[model samples]
Target: MDIRQRLATNLRRLRLEKGWSQEEFADQAGIHRTYVSDIERGARNPTITVVERLARPLGMSPSELLA
Candidate 1:
């Protein structure tokens, strides 16, 4: 899969592993819930800053998120 697909898969897997609902994850990530949905769906081309926001709550680096 491509980076977007990889991110979508990893993000969903990580979020589920954390037992966090999308809304809850979004809150913890300091991002919008809908945006998180879009990201999980591989529909959003998140910038580095937004990737950082997501990575922080997941206890990983942005590169990890992409990986």
Candidate 2:
């Protein structure tokens, strides 16, 4: 898969693993739920900064999210 797809897949998996909804994940990540949805759908190409923001709540690094 491409990076966007990889990111989306990993994000979804991590969120599910943590038993969090998009809103919950977004709240913890300090981002908008809509943005989280966009990322999960692979419709948003997040910057490294955004990745960092999201990764923090997931207990992972941006590179791990990319993986």
Candidate 3:
């Protein structure tokens, strides 16, 4: 898959593993719930910094999220 798709898949998988809904995951990631939904849907092209923020709560690195 493409990087966006990879990120979306990984993000969703990790979030599910943590038992957090999209809203809960967004709260933990310090981003908007809609943004999280967008990312999970591969509908947003977030910056590297935002990727880092998303990864932080899941104990991952941005690269992991994009992998």
5-60, model 1: which lDDT tens digit per residue?
89999999999999999999999999999999999999999999999999999999
lDDT of 1 at 19: 99
- TM-scores for all candidates: the values are 0.96, 0.97, 0.96
The TM-score of predicted model 1 comes to 0.96
Taken over the whole model, the C-alpha lDDT of each candidate is 0.95, 0.95, 0.93
Q: Considering only N, C-alpha and C atoms within 3 Å, which residue pairs clash in candidate 2?
A: none
Off by over 4 Å in 2: none
Question: What's the C-alpha lDDT at position 55 in model 2?
Answer: 94
Task: State the lDDT of candidate 3 residue by residue for 1-67, as single tens digits.
Answer: 9899899999999899989999999999899999999999999999999999999999978887787
Per-residue lDDT for 1-67 in model 2, tens only?
A: 9999999999999999999999999999999999999999999999999999989998889999898
- Judge candidate 2 against the unseen true structure and give its global Cα lDDT, from 0 to 1: 0.95
- Residue pairs with backbone atoms closer than 3 Å in model 1 (clashes): none
Name the regions of candidate 3 deviating beyond 4 angstroms: none
